[model samples]
Target chain A: MAKVSKEELLHIANLADLNIKEDEIDNYLKNLQDILNFANIVNNANTDGLGETIGENDQCNVFRKDEVKEFKDNELLLANAKEQERNMFKIPKVIQ
Target chain B: MDITNLTVHELQEKLAKQELTSEEIVQAYVNRINAKEKDVKAFVTTLCDEALKEAKEIDEKRKNGEKLSSLAGIPIGIKDNMCTKGVKTTCSSRMLENFVAPYNATVVEKLNEENLIDLGKLNMDEFAMGASTEYSYFKKTCNPWNLKTVPGGSSGGSAAAVAANLVPWALGSDTGGSIRQPSSFCGVVGLKPTYGLVSRYGLVAFASSLDQIGPITKDVRDSAMLLNIIAGHDERDTTSYNMQKKDYTKTLNGNVKGLKIGIPKEYFGEGINEEVKAKLEEAIETYKKLGAEVEEFSLDIAQYALATYYIIACAEASSNLGRFDGIRYGYRTENYTNLKELYKNSRSEGFGPEVKRRIILGTYVLSSGYYDAYYKKAQQVRTLVKKEFDKAFEKYDVLLTPTSPTVAFEMGTRSENPLEMYLADICTVSVNIAGLPGISIPCGVNGDNMPIGMQLIGNKFEEEKILNAAYTFEQEYKFREKYQPEFKG
Candidate 1:
């Protein structure tokens, strides 16, 4: 069973966009390696040529009539917002 | 007037007979929710006031002698993962903690049209990831029979509430064995409709391809009734089937005589606990006595199901959950210098360990170099698994196995060993792999007095046959008749 090196773990975490605390890195690396090693058993199976299906129901291109739909009151919708502006949600500005 | 205890079919029957008003039925269930839910921790929120208001309108319509649908006034637990137009549909996760859906799921809309009372949201595995309700960010759902053990999850709360008679039935989504395993542990009927049978528009995606919303109830009758309400085509859900739904209740009485029931040798293997095996063997004998021909069968691809399922489910989950980053809105971090840091920090803090583990594994599989060996290969194996089932079904009308290898273990027992815990799903994963319709019916009590369930699998779109065999076994076995949940106030 190959273990994920500390450097590999850090690299994968970076790709996942996660920054593991330095103290947490070692254990996360070991645990993740265990899971990966465990998953290698799946490699044992031979999947030759089956097309990938994202979901069941062979149907595609279902169309709904486009129409206005009433939903919750806007007052209730933004009631819990941390910040609000002009009856819309406000968040940390991206370009700041 | 405790109609919450009444099966939906019976409640519908009573409403049709004018013996109970819709308001009265809804109020009955609402009252039960008020009194009992505090103990079971089944619901994330109780919508009794809202439900009663709707119930009153339903009553007014019926008083004017309007046409009443079968689902009208029947209270049903909607798993938190399904979106409700104005209700909080949180997926029992902190990520969606403050998120209330703006649109209803396709099934929820169908139930609304059918006049089913929303019993608010039942808790679930955060993002439908775990096999135990323990993973929910909300309060843990307790098994009604024994509070110490888990209710079996990510549909744990759905099964627990139903078993406690807090509500007669509820809707649940099955990915892997979420519905069936929990049903077995909670001692209720849980059906995973043939994929695409019921629409998944509102179900929060775990593994989109593997997810199917279905009914978890005290009996198969309610499963059929709920199926009737939720099964149909919806433009919003492209995967929803356009196939004909022949009132599933009608199929309940279909004769199982001469039906070929396949018994897989792999399912009854050395790994199965002795107690679960005894009950399953008894169930087979009972089916034989009921005039169904039992035949031995093999699914050559069975051994590979879990591995394929994990790779496929995790890969999809990794992508589906990508929508939850701290951007358009789910959980956003209190502090982050930039978008990248925000996404990373918020998700790392938000998702539980099991979920993070899966996302990482899935991410790796779908990553550039490993896609063929992991993701693509798993897809191919999934095909082989499906092909194997197609062959088996050609020789048999239905397949039977123990729903789970053992009864519910201690809540935290397998929490440490993810591999050991995943093994618990061994018998049930194949049905999901084949995208076949399957139902878990109570067989009898294990000597320890825990519930045991027997699974019945049928060919895709052949739910009628599975229901036929299950109904026959249910009727003849009479185990469920004596299977009372030992709940105390």
Candidate 2:
């Protein structure tokens, strides 16, 4: 098995858009190592020429007919929103 | 009947006959919850006033001689992962503690149409990761059997609620053993219907492909009644099957005579507690007496199921949980100088220990360099696991196994060790990986006197067959009459 170095953990966390604290890097590395050890067991199984099982059973199109439908209560729809700005959901600005 | 101990069938009968009012039933359960929920910590949010209001409407409808749905006037507990409109839908994580759902889950919506009473949103593991439900950011839910033991989780609160008789039945999401293990621990019937049998449009995503909403009830028939209402195709859920709905009660009358039940040998050996194994063997003998045949089968791929499930479930969770940033109506920390720090600080402080652990593990497995070796390999092994079941089901009508290897351990037993808790799901992960329907029915009590569940696995979209087998066994075993806990409150 290839070694998962400290630099690799940071790189993966970046890809996942997760910001891990500097001190918790060691703990994450150790946890990652244990998980890898467990995943290694699956490596021993023979899965040659097998298709991946992505979703459960099968995925079929469940669509509705295009037509006008009665709308739900707008007030009820907006009741759970923390910030309702002009009938729209508002969120903190995302950094570029 | 004590409101907690009465099954949905009995409750509905009383309401239909005007012997009891829906409002009266709702008040009874709410009053019962008032006396007990403080020590149990099973509810994250209780719809006390809302439930009473809906119950009054249901009773008024009945008085007007209007048709009522099967679940009408029944009180059902919901897992925190399932969205209840206008109610807090925290997945027992600090990240979404203040988050309330704008819309209801399809199951919840259907139950609402029937004017069923909503008791509350039950507790769960943070982001539905851990097995003991101890990883929840909120206070852990204590098992009703013994306050010290854990109610096996992700859906621990749902199972604990039903078992403790807090409600007649509950809706829970099972990704792997979440519903079944806790049901086994709490001594109730928990079913994980064939993937896509029930809609997942509004269930908070843990692992989209692995999750299915099903009922945890006091008996097999109650499970059937709940499934009859919730099982159907929904246009909003792409994975839901476009299959015709059936009256599940019809299948219970079908005899299990000449039915072949496959007993996978992989589940019986190693790690399985001796008491659980003995009870399983005894149940098999009982099946033979009832004219059913039990035979041995092999699922070599099952040994790798847990490994595959964690990789795939975590990979999906890593992606699904991306929607919970400080923005989008969850927790927000304004103490940060920049937008990036705001997102980071909020999630870092908001999520619990278990959710963070899974995110890190999932991110690593699905990372570019290791994706093929870990995630891809697990997916391939998953096919092998499903192939094993398909090969077995060709001859056998259903498969049986121990729902959980050991009985419920003490509350603080595996809290510190995450891997040990993960292993408790070894028997259950294969069913989820295969995407087949499964049910965990209480077979008997172990030497320790805690309930033990025997599982049944059926072919895809064959929830009725699984329910038939459980109902048949329930009638013969009389497991419903064996309530061990004190539910007086």
Candidate 3:
């Protein structure tokens, strides 16, 4: 089993897009190490020929008719938006 | 009369015969919520005025000689994770704390079609992540059995609400024993239906493949009734199975004679509390007395289930929760200077620590250089886990186990140790892993006076068998009536 160093924990947190604070990194590393260790138990299970289960059922490529429909509740949809302008979500500047 | 104590079936009979009005039933539950909610902290929001208005509308329809479903005028609560259009579905997280849903969850829509009065949104572990409501960004829901102890979660508020009689029933989603564990802790009935039995269109995703919504009720019959209304396929949810419709209530004939029951011996091993194990043994004896054939069997994959469950569920969660990136609805951080910082800051400020931990772990396992070792290995073991259930089901009709290793522990005891908290879900996580239907019914109470729940697991879509077996045991044991919680407000 590999120990999750503080650097690794921060790297993982960065990939997950979570801002791990300087003070909170140690706590997270400790907890993450414990959890990863627990999760390592699966490495011992003998599953050589088994295929992975993506879901419970056998359905694949489930599609619906590509027809346009009108939704009359644009305001309701945008009601929770942090900022809205002309029925579109207003976000911070993207693309420098 | 204490109308709040009556089950949904009894209340339905009264409503049908004009002995009670839907408005009166709504008022009764609202009054109970008003009196007891402060202590229990079950609801994130209560729709008292709205519920009364809907109840009155139902009464008017009934007086006009219009036919209605049996669930019409019945009061129910929804877990905060399920969308209810025009109502805030917060998932007890600050991330979506003020986000009003644009559409109703499919289950909520089905309940609306039945004209069932939705009392409000019940609290849960934030993003349905934790084993206790202590992790909720909103208020922590306490066990009705004891104020200091936790109501097992992430469906804590749903179970606590029903156990406290705040509502006759409530909807709860289970990924890893979220429904059944809390139901066990609070001495209520919680069912995690077969994964595809119910549609997940409007439910806020935690783990798409494993998450399923079911009922939390005061008794087994109410569970069946709620399942009947909510279980069906929808085109919106591709995973929803096209099952032949059956009235779940019709199977509650209380006859389990010659039923084949298996007790997974591994579930009763070390770490199971003595009182809880004793109660399970007593429940097995009850099934035997009812002429059900009970025997012990080995489900060896049980030990690895928790590990596999955490890996898969978190991996799915990390990807699913990626949608809350501050561009759309949900919380936004004012501390960011650019888009990338915006994403990180908003999530860090929004989600709780446990949610962050899972997200980080998920990202790590699914990240490059680790996917094959961690994530893929867990999936392969998942196949092995499902095969074990399939092998067990070939010989036995249903499997019995303790819903949790221990009764509700005092709050703050396990929350500090995240691993210890995760261990609480050991007995319940495997059911979600295998995509099977599992129900937790009150077996008896422990010496601490906290409730002990016995889990009855069925093969995929074989809910009726477990329901029949549970009904027979419910009729004979009558555990709820004998050990009612006294919440003196």
Candidate 4:
């Protein structure tokens, strides 16, 4: 069984960019540990001489014409934005 | 005939004969929804006015003697995961509670092109994550057969709505058995098309590789009808197959004589309820009577499927859901001092516990140190599972299994334990992992009278074979007559 420590849990949360509250970490730790332990069964399976399957279908490298099509409606695109300026999404400032 | 009770084909027949106008049909369904919404709780948004207006237009076209498609004017429900332009496609999460789609999903557009009346957005697990609707941020959908039991999810509402006769048919997306399990629990027919058989453009992503939109309906033929309309290529979805268009309805010839069927012992093993297993056995016997060759087979890699599914699905989910960072769409935190806090607090506050847990688990598997051990290894195992199915398909036209290990349990029965909750998907996830077409048809009922579903899995692009096999069984057995929900409305 894979044991997940508190520090590792917090580090994972950080990597996923999720904010875990201090008290909630323990619950997350226990649940994640349980899931990981269950998921560890894959390690025992013999995967030798097997290829990875990233997708199910055989079709690949499908390309469309390089012509640009107009969406023509920026208002609709920006409709769900929390804040917008001049039809563009407004976000917290970066690059101090 | 009651407008709400008519199948897609029956309703289309009536519409063509002008026995009932589209407005009248839409009103009847709305009335049913209004009466049963309190009990079934199947919809997140009901488009009553919009549907009525569209129904009137169809009626106008019918009066002019304009040619109409088979699905024209039939009311159907859309699972909340599929985007409908200007309608709230919440995926049953607080994160997208107020978010309205700017565009229609490809399937929604196809439905619109057929002039099908849209009833509403059906309830589902938040981002199609859980086996039961209990994980939904909205109200849990109750099984129409018995209110005490849960409707299987994350397409719970899709199956429940059809079972309650709220809609004759509804769309559902299956990733790890969301469509089939829920349909099994709710006593309806659900079909998950082979991955890329149906376009996934504009579907709210939850484990993209596994997710394929399908139909949940009262019977197998209605599933075939809906599949005919939605199964096609779209350049918008890069993964969408470029195969020639198929009329899935043509496959329902109801001939399964000499069809090869493999019964996977792993699916019928221990954890399955005795009654459910008996029902499946009886179904197998019925298949033999229909002249289909049935043989017991072993899928050795079956035990490893759940672990592989969770790792791959959650890992993909973590990457896909990263788009919900309070920037472009969905919920944004009210108070955040910086961009980092904006991403973190919004996701933490917006998403429910199950969604967060999956995200965390997904992140862990895909993280630097564990990537090769968990995520990559799961993919390799996925290849093995697919290969096993491929080998089985060489001898069999379709693989048969119980859709769920047990019939629908009481609400909150497995919610406390995440592992127990995932076990409900034991029989259905491997199909998604292998990206094969599978269907769940109600075979019989358990002791508690809840429905038990038997699954028919086919090779890739072999939906026709499974559909015909299910059609044959449905014709001979008449499972629908055994248990009918008494709709008080």
After superposing all C-alphas onto the true structure, candidate 2 shows an RMSD in angstroms of 2.4
Instruction: Evaluate every candidate with DockQ and list the scores.
Output: 0.45, 0.54, 0.85, 0.85
Tens-place lDDT per residue, model 2, B335-424, is 676666766777777787678778778888887778899898998898898888889989999999999998889988888777788899
Residue B428 local lDDT, model 4 = 94
Per-residue lDDT of candidate 1, residues B1-489 (tens digit): 456667777887898888988788777777777777777799987788888898888888878878878667777888999988778888888888978776788888888888888877998888988787888898888887777788888899999999887777899999998999999998899999988888888789999888999999878877887888788776666776777667888878847778898998888887899999998998888878778899987665555888788888888988888877765456777888776787888888877777877787788788887888778877777777887888897899999999998898777887766667777778877788778899998899876568898899999988888877877777776665676767532
Tens-digit per-residue lDDT, B1-489, candidate 3: 799999999999998788999999999999999999999999999999999999999999999999998669989999999999988899999999998998899999999899998899999999999888999998989988899889989999999999999999999999999999999999999999999999999999999989999999988999999999999989889999986898998878999888999999999999999999999999999999999999999998777999999999999999999999887888999998888999999999999999998999899999988899899999999999999999999999999999999999888998989999999999999999999999999999987778899999999999999999989999999986689986522
Which regions of candidate 1 are displaced past 4 Å?
A48-96
lDDT of 3 by residue, A1-96 (tens): 887778888888888899988999888888888999999999999999999987888777788899888888898888888889988998888877
Candidate 1, chain A: TM-score against the reference? 0.74
DockQ, model 2, C-alpha based: 0.54
Residue B450 lDDT (model 3): 82
Alpha-carbon lDDT of model 3:
0.92
Sort by DockQ, best first: 4, 3, 2, 1
lDDT (0-100) at residue B346 of candidate 4? 93
**Candidate 4, residue B403: how far the Cα is off, in Å:** 0.1
lDDT of each: 0.81, 0.84, 0.92, 0.90
Weakest 10 consecutive residues, lDDT, candidate 3 chain B?
B480-489
Candidate 2's docking class is medium
lDDT of 2 by residue, A4-92 (tens): 89888777776665677889887777777877788789999988899887766554544678988775766655554555788776656
Off by over 4 Å in 2: A57-96, B486-489
Give residue B1's error in model 2 in angstroms: 3.6
